[model samples]
Target: MRSSSRLKRAALPRSAPATSAGGSKTDGNHGLIAGTAAKRRTKKEADDAQGPSKPAPKKRRKVIPVKEPEPAASGSEASTQTSHADTKQPEQHLPSLPLDVLYEIFSVLDPHGLIQLTHTCKYLCTVLASRKLDWAWKVARKNSPGLETWDPPKDMSEMRWASLVADTSCSNCGAGGVTSVDFRLRMHLCEQCSKDGLIHSSRLAKAYPDLLPIVRELVPYTNKKLHSNKKSDKYFWIDDLQSMDKKIRKLQAEDPSAVDDFCKERRDLVKSILGRASYLRQWHARYMESRVDFRMDQIAGRFQAIGYQFEDLDNPKFYLHPLVRLDTPLTDAEFAEMREVLQPVLAQIKQQRTKAERSSKVLELYDQYKKTLLPIQRIYVPDDGNFLWKYPKFSALLTRDTSLEITDAEWAEATDALPTYLSRFIEAKRDKHIALMHDRYPAPDAMEFITLAASPQALQHAREETMPHFAGPLELAIATFTHREDTVVRYNRLFTGRELCNSWFEKVKFQFADRESGLVAQMVRMAGLNPRSTTATEMDDLGAQFFCRTCHNTDHERAKAAQEPHTLWACSWRGLLDHFRGSHPTAIKIGLVNHEFYTLERTHNVIDIFENWCCNHCSEEAVAFLPRQAADDHLQAAHGVLTPSVGRDVFFRPPALNVMAPHGIQSYYQFKDSIPPQASLSTKEPSPTS
Candidate 1:
């Protein structure tokens, strides 16, 4: 409110004390009264009594008989006093503080106190509601940490207190309940004492899982308000077990058979998806190795070198890689004829020095031959699939094949047709390859691979390059894929367990009478099934030790090398070795996996033939541009040469198995949240809401 308005309100008159007429006290013992007198009786009192009677008779003319009092005027002081006396006291009241004092009080309050005070009193609530008050609190939180934190050192007192106060209200009867809800005051409240205890704890745990870790840390260290004895370790353990038992009972009561059925369904789906995931990875890997380099070249050439200039000063000429007018040479016969015709115009061309004049002269002479044919250079790879398999049955099958064969047409019927068809087909194939790669590409064990891979420049010094040995199988596997690069490997299950222990295995190595399982095998089993330590150091040590005993011992050079080469360093080696060790020889490094795009497109083709025996449109499209059967036939008919097929298998495909399936999702949207909060209703539904 404005200062003027406040001043006017402060000037308001207060109630006056009640009084009788003539300024005397009123009746009910609240006003003045006259005293009664008796006559004197004595010998000398005859004269004295006569004198007293005479004195009384002389004053009997009455006090009010003098000048009459004037009537009070409406605007006079007397009238104002009378009006004020009639007014009653106000019922509402306010603190006896100046505005500045109130502001100071508001400034001292923390966020929690402000929110509470805002709800408690009308005046305080108004002050808190003001935007200015909000700005003040924001500044305070930013500037004054101590004021904000009630007990900062002790369990992050601000948050702990806020959490306690907020959750203290009883959920059933609310705050009005006989038992005030302050569960945090005690470590665990007995449900027997209050039936709502279990329900409250469950709700609290569900609502505040993020805060649970901090609470769990603090709860064990401090004494609860009411549960000093019950807060011991034994009681806490019993409470936890009891809570788990209660939860189990509740779940069983809700739907025992349904839960079992759901678990079974989940297991089966996981198995199916896991199976598909393997095929997808194998196909993706082959595809990537085939086309990764080509794709990288295109990425580097087109995108990386878009805006650059190169000048050859030594040649003393300005050479432009003309976008429109590329250089072409005329044959001797054509040149002779052109020269003969241009001889007459040469003088005129020279005489005309201005650009416009020369241009006009040249245009007039070449009017009839304005159109020029710039020979369209072949940029795409040549397709030789049909020629390679030209047998009648093979041709028929290959003609239908979209994987290796780019097109079915023997020749282009129109000029535009070739470019359009090639563009569309390449695009379609690239897309297919990319999808296949994503599906097939296995997630690499980056940590392990980086740890193992040969350091840069070390490959040159090494006597034996492991990558080269594997490179052939790896590249062949890569080349096997026509589209998706990642579609090259399949694993039944991802092994996550302990690693082989070098010390234990080494100790058991030459004991003649000792009866222990193969140390390597035992170590592998232990690492796979149960690890001794959770630290990264332990896993790495175990992995390195195992590698030394098995893969490293064969080559002295490899053993001597401080850092392993590309193949040994790869993360896949760790994952695969670990995988094999887990389930004996059931799973091993059957194929390589990669994540690049183009490689996957090529690999997709390989996987289509090798694993799924299906066509991927994306890889097919990419291969179309590179040179397909039709293009190869064109080359035979036109250039009579074919490009190699080694580069055709690189394409990346997306994983086929859904990563979110285990979480009860058919598509990405089903799990809007990390975990589904809503229970499935088709199994069972709550009774219809009346």
Candidate 2:
């Protein structure tokens, strides 16, 4: 409010307060004359208050009442005989504070606070509530952090801006639960007011059928508010309809287009408005979200910097509200103070977690050592009773009771240092197994072959590397080796008890130990089953069922170096070993199983016909050997001719088996000197060697 207007607030008449000359209760021409005089006086006072624009101090003003009260009878000339009681009639209520004091107070207060202060008193409310006091509100809006950022709309008065920011009471119901102002409706409303009092634009059109198009043209069908049908539905504020009705009538009176060409103009206007409203809605949404997101980020970041997980902590209603004003979340002094207090507490939690994790590590290592390693040591190596106790650290690890907690340092000393000792023991056990195998089959590379047989990746790797011709028979063995669905049945019913540790050589001999099909008969049977070629005859070695022609898999360099026949057919696992050995040479060298993607797309035509009994030129038998290159070399080097059968692999027919029935899968004579296959689904013990 202007300084001169404020002066009137401090001295307004009790019954005849000065008002606009154009107000409803104006006293005609006389009131207009008085209003003009008052206007002139106000201008003079304003000029005097703001004589210099360069930041000068405001001088205190002594207000003079517009009209003076008549002198009372008890004045200095009162009768001496007048009683003391008559002289002191009731005192008038203390007059409001001087306008200068009110102005100074409003200058320092926030815009919201200034509006609230006006409501507690009558005179101050009238002066501050006037739309003419826009300059006062402009000063007020700058007092608060969030309010200063808002650029008031051109058509909005400072009074409306103040109301939108400071009014907490719902405009529709006077309920004090308003969260924010509805800019479209130009009112502040509570949640219930927003939900129940807001109607879809269709509802407005339905209610006013004759003016539907005009309503659509004027009213914005904003869908900014989210609800169940937010995507396709548009809403209109119900409380705005009355004002809209008045506005429409006013438009009809002033705009000739509304009457001259109603339908088409209204339709065009509606289309234009909808387009503008869509762009405005998008801009408004981005603006609103950016503001809320910025404050939320600040609050979250500040809390997290002090190690507070705000979302993890249940949101408490009392603490969350009031911190945010009109969607601007303010992290005030209290939150900063709370952060300082939490930092030390967060440090304590870190220390405690470190200790707990150390304890968990101790427990986990102890359990793993007990379940897998201890069972094997107890059952197989009986002579090594209490052997672990020989080492002080190992002894300590074994004796520690589960109920007792171990320090991180002590656990690391015992568990970390014991692996080397345990590895030595495992090596000794493997040597014993190797010795037993040598006693039966006697091979220089028996140990390497046994290690490959025990690998976990022996099936899938084998399948991927097999030549397309032999993929069928080899895959049959691979299927049995994996046995995904019936593994328990295969392992327990067939491969258990004393038979689990059988030698590879013994197992191979047992495949033919069925005592039915003779050794030669079994080879013909498996050769017939081989998919590489229908041509079946005799294979040079046991490995004819699966080995790749060019690259041999497994760490079987020892066996190959010794020229051990690439034989021993059990499971298609040879293919997996071939791929592993060729592609993951480092893993094979280190005796490690690599999980990396590896391949072995080697050509094998020469190896397929190395020993098949057919004319080398074009027998299905030649394709079955996988030795296309080797066979070509055999033809070229030894016979001085290139074999037509080098690259092309074609299976013609299976040779008749010696037995009427297919030879037993375990025909022994053919594999007596070789390592046994571990990829079979069946794990029967080898028949007593005879």
Candidate 3:
């Protein structure tokens, strides 16, 4: 009865109306549900009547709950809420594009941009590597600015050529900073990788003796000579050598007779590769040079936009700047980022250059001023003038604000004023010396409350004798301070340290006393006088008969060989004192008292005393009791009197012995072989001549 009811219900479906739960006819959704059920039943019956093949079940999608619309907000509130919603919206990624669209997009990219795009995702990498996309890579290479003239080799694909040209990382070890491309090997290698992977031709036979001769000839090689005298070594890429070796071995194993054909084909391929590599090498050099020039121009333009000018834009500081050194086109944003660091460096360089230029100008003006002042100095201050620049006033003039503006006329005026500055400088120097002397050697009466004073004559004589000692040390200190060329430091005494001056004075005073005592001892010994009892006047009476043993001995052999007289260096006691002070102040030696020199001097003294002749025409300062012949020569030469009577123009008087040889001795060789009277005399201080 159920089966019959089901069959009857299934058969009654033509435009059937559905009933409600109350058994009344319903007009809305019930009719629609009944019609959809009847249609599904009919389709099932149709599928059951057909053959057994059935479609796979479809997965049901999740149903999301619908949100109802809210009441409209006020205009400002609505905008605020809309903006908040926009801000909270999830980030959207690049949508998948059709291959046609991607190909067009990639076509416009450069090699570097295409390389970067390939690394973004595996999808792009796989798509870019596909054979269909090869046209896009060719377009990219073609559109590249500098590489438009170049194309991939026969064996190299477009993508590979782009990577080889664009990639900066080593293909072997993945190291960065690579700028060179080995197009023959289709690899970018760093210095270290190249070193490790390259096999020199010199080592190739020894390292791989079994490597075929044809394989060696067929491999592309790089010629590099470490030294000029040596022949360039051929370096083959190790991988290329191995690959060719392996290929040759496989060919021999597969077909023993086909090796020659393989070698010929490889030789042709390698020849083409080498020729292409050579051209690429030259192109790479020019391209790198152009790139560097372009980068420098970019840097210069950026600097100029900010009001800076560089005469040498290729200066290492600018050329090596991180942003400027990049192997890419510099963008405005990149320049702006680097400006903060680079601008300060530019400013410093500009300041340094400006300072150097100003210093050069100042030095030029100084040199001109120096030249002008030198002649004036030679005329006015010849005796004691120092370099003009070594004066404080002159240095100040050079460094003054208006120094650069100083004209030739202004310099002339300055030169005229230099004499006055020199006077003040001398005065100041004297005052400083006096002050240092006072500090070093205080006056005896300085501490004595009621000390008796010396006579004016005595005081003046004492000062005259002492002043020269201070002058030497003061000059030494001045020279030491002015050793550098800086004008500011050349003359400033404050910069010349006070302690240095004091130390110099102390040193000079001590050395002077020691040297003077040694000289006095030497003089007394040579004069055969009692050192304890010999007065200054007594020593002076010895006249200028002494010679500096140090100087004479140093030049004795040379002089004797040349037959030249050694008497030229002979001087009186006073002259010897001056010579010692000037030439050998630190050492004191008098010529040994040899009998030959002693007898010669004594004989000359006797002749002068016996003649008793003097020059009466000359003033007291010029008067001298000369020997008869010497007197005649003097009258003729000095007074222009060829003949003068002893009672008239000349007078007779006994004079002290004048041991000075006013004219050099002509008989020096005559006494050269004479024996010393005191052969045992040594450098030891002689016993007081008792």
Give residue 183's error in model 2 in angstroms: 4.9
lDDT-based ranking, best first?
Answer: 3, 2, 1
Model 3, residue 623: distance off in Å is 42
Top candidate, metric lDDT: 3
Q: What lDDT tens digits, residue by residue, belong to model 2 across residues 598-662? A: 12222333224334222223212233334335545645654455533311222111122111111
| Total colliding residue pairs, candidate 3 | 2
Residue 418 in candidate 1 has what lDDT? 30
Candidate 2: worst 10 consecutive residues by lDDT? 1-10
The stretch of ten residues in a row with the least summed lDDT in candidate 3 is 1-10
- lDDT by residue for model 3 over 212-286, one digit each (tens)? 777888778766522224335677777677777888889899998998887888789788977788788778867
TM-score for each candidate, following the candidate numbering: 0.13, 0.39, 0.41
**Stretches > 4 Å off in candidate 3:** 1-167, 172-175, 181-186, 191-217, 221-258, 268-290, 311-316, 351-365, 376-690
* Candidate number that wins on lDDT, 2 or 3: 3
Cand. 2 Cα-lDDT: 0.41
